[model samples]
Target chain A: MIINVRELLPFLIPLIIFQLLLMISALTMIVKQRRFKYLNRVAWIIIVVVFNIVGPVLYFVMERK
Target chain B: MNQISALFKKEAVESIRNFKLFLLLAVFIIIGIISPLTAYLMPDIMAMVMKDAGIKFELPVVTAVDSYVQFFGNMNQLGLPILVIVTGSILTNEFSRNTLINLLTKGLKRHNVMLVKFLYTILMWTVVYVFGAVTAYLYTIYYWENELENILAAFGLTWLYGIFLISVIMMASAIFRTSFLGVLFTVLGVVIIMIIASIYPMTAEYLPQYLLTSNMSLLTGETGMSDVMPAVLITAGASILIFLLSIVTFNKAVM
Candidate 1:
């Protein structure tokens, strides 16, 4: 079965959105818990903010205390 | 022996209590089986849909490679994330929850904790992966038998990718106290490696991503086994190094 790359594009946007939502929620959790003690907070914050919504979410999850 | 056995026992028992791992397993199983099946059915399904318009062409049926390709694709793109999800917090949970701190104070060696959790998660990935591969293989064999040059090589690539993924998960889990962070780090690492690999095809064989796709060319005899040896070596080496480093990092990482 051959899958054209074109057909796959339709799925990626939503996957990205879901990822962003997941990131936002994760960051919210860390923020809510008030746990921030790391040497990489700026790098972490930039990753979250730059990657768009998911960037921060992913960073928050990574930065969790 | 005690650490290995007790860790396994604890992890097994914990697996029973936690639905998170089970849920991830279920999702993985679905992706593993369905992605190939969908790819296999695509031609026929598309033909059927287009049949009404008389837009017909010879429908190419699916093969074992197709299923394997599906397996690899799903495993790399989606399955890795699931492993990250399960492993991201396996060790950290206890620390974050104030559960492991008491246990560690009682007498657990930091290395023992890392090793146990690492082994357990490896075992978990192996079990689920074997189950998924076996199911897909049986179904593939049932439907098509041609062009299966090396069943082992194709599927082996998928598992090898898992080895790399689990290693990343272990390290990421250690680096981050939370699961999301662990997964993010692992994903970021993978993407970075992939980007670097794109620039250097020579390094392609060593990339974990290649462990999933390179075997297809090898099986079809399009590339020599030598094409994949470097990847196998790199993935194995990286996995071992990461596991060890994760232990060191975990030993120092505060819960």
Candidate 2:
């Protein structure tokens, strides 16, 4: 499958940047906060990096105790 | 008056310090950007995917109305839930952290605490809604130059619905012991209102939920000011009434 990255760059760029910003912010908080409600730091790091859009948001809403 | 302002300022500063304000604004702004972007690019994306599968389909021409519909739909589905999740634990978490007791012991009136939280949360809602709406408006106009009818009223009605939701969630948070329970009760309240509105469609104009579902219709001129004014007024009234109930509940709460 030949996907044209150049063709979609205009539309995909903003979304990618936003996703990165959210992830970085979540990761910084996860690293700084030493509290855990359900999962530990390693588990949350995995979740945040693995889930992409939902991972960071889940951390922010549920795991940020 | 001084006490109220002091409390309000305290809440506002707390919200900022905790990054709730920044997080929510970012979420809403992203939603705002994605709505119109998706509406604009969906046809091409679909075409590309279909071509890969050896299928052919024609998509209808997208317009400003489509953009606004997408924006409102995203706000209703994801944005509202985010609002509930963020503020659903406002009072319950305070109770859990023992801050409520600390403030009360310091001679802060319970009602003032409740009122301050309510005012700040609603103020945040208003600002966030405006941010999303303005971004969507600018992108839609730039992409598709068309005039919409009753634009202000459409935005106003949606904002009112948001206020109504925050009121219900605040009351639920005050009544429930755990933040999770508070969120559950608020979701249940919304579901019940939806069921009742569906059963009595004729009275939808009197139901606060009507404003949320019919926002797009208002922009397209299918719904008029007369059709929306009733729901707007009802939502405003219900927000105030439920807010009062939340205050009473907070006062009687055993914190």
Candidate 3:
């Protein structure tokens, strides 16, 4: 049941990069905006950066001005 | 036509500036990428888990079609709601910002405004949809090489459902002055359709909701064109009717 990391790198790398990009963008916007209707900016930033893919997506869809 | 074009430009710019386009494409592309990757890695992941539990089982060889099934499943469960949330505020945002009143007083036709919004939202959906579909197609090709059966029909049915969903959202936003109510109505509309589909097995054949649920089967050839054509027609017809209704309601709605 050993999986080769090399064979999977092509897919894994892109997925990780896309996820990180989303996370970073969400965090940066949270810091810069500093205002949200529902949650405080600090909570929003923590949620966006900490939960990986779903976190950033939740922030964008349900949050953000 | 000129008025419609002008409003469409406005809608396009608003979508871009608000980051809806970027967020949607990013989410969909991630769905596209992860679906196939999950399918490709399923066997190894399961084997490792089973080894730890001292259990053994035979797993079916995953194919390109399996990836597509996964892709469509994600589209149904995750992608559709994301689509709803992104476009749910189309009209309500204008209402809240008082832009709708400004534009109405400036001689913008109500029906034209609704039509333009519908058109632009669909256009964005199409672009991101293609991006996601192509990404999934390329990765599936790389991992498991094979041509999918009824590929066009599968995509077409799902694409029609997306259009239907957007129309429903548009109608909801048009009728409701608040973005939250718009989203609520849209979700309620979908839930009612789903509930009816489940309650009456006979009517499921004609329900548009069937298209979303059965897309994977169509790709796998377990479902035929004959099975889906009725649902497809009903979906397309319902969408058009909803669109027309939205226009009429929007015209009369107090800004």
| Top DockQ hit | 3
As for lDDT, the candidate ahead, 2 or 3, is 3
lDDT (10s digit) by residue, model 1, range B1-255: 776688779888887555444444554555555655666676767877877788867777666677777767777776776666556677667755777787788787888878888777788888877776776666566666665676677677777777777777777777775555655666577767686776777766567777666767866778776778887888889889988998888888766
| Deviating ranges (above 4 Å) for candidate 2 | A1-13, B48-58
lDDT per residue (tens digit) for residues B116-137 in model 3: 8898889998988888888898
List where candidate 3 sits over 4 angstroms from the true fold.
A62-65, B52-54
Which candidate gets the maximum lDDT versus the true structure? Answer: 3
Q: What local lDDT score does residue B8 receive in model 2, on the 0 to 100 scale?
A: 85
Better of 1 and 3 by TM-score: 3
Global lDDT scores for all candidate models: 0.67, 0.80, 0.82
Best by TM-score: 3
lDDT-wise, the better of 1 and 3 is 3
Docking class of 2: acceptable
For model 1, the superposed segments whose C-alpha errors exceed 4 Å read A1-65, B48-57
Q: How many clashing pairs per prediction, in order?
A: 7, 0, 0
User: Measured by TM-score, how close is model 2 to the native structure?
Assistant: 0.90
Q: For model 2, what TM-score is found for chain B?
A: 0.92
Please give me the DockQ of candidate 2 compared with the native complex: 0.38
Q: How far is candidate 2 from the true structure (C-alpha RMSD, Å)?
A: 2.5
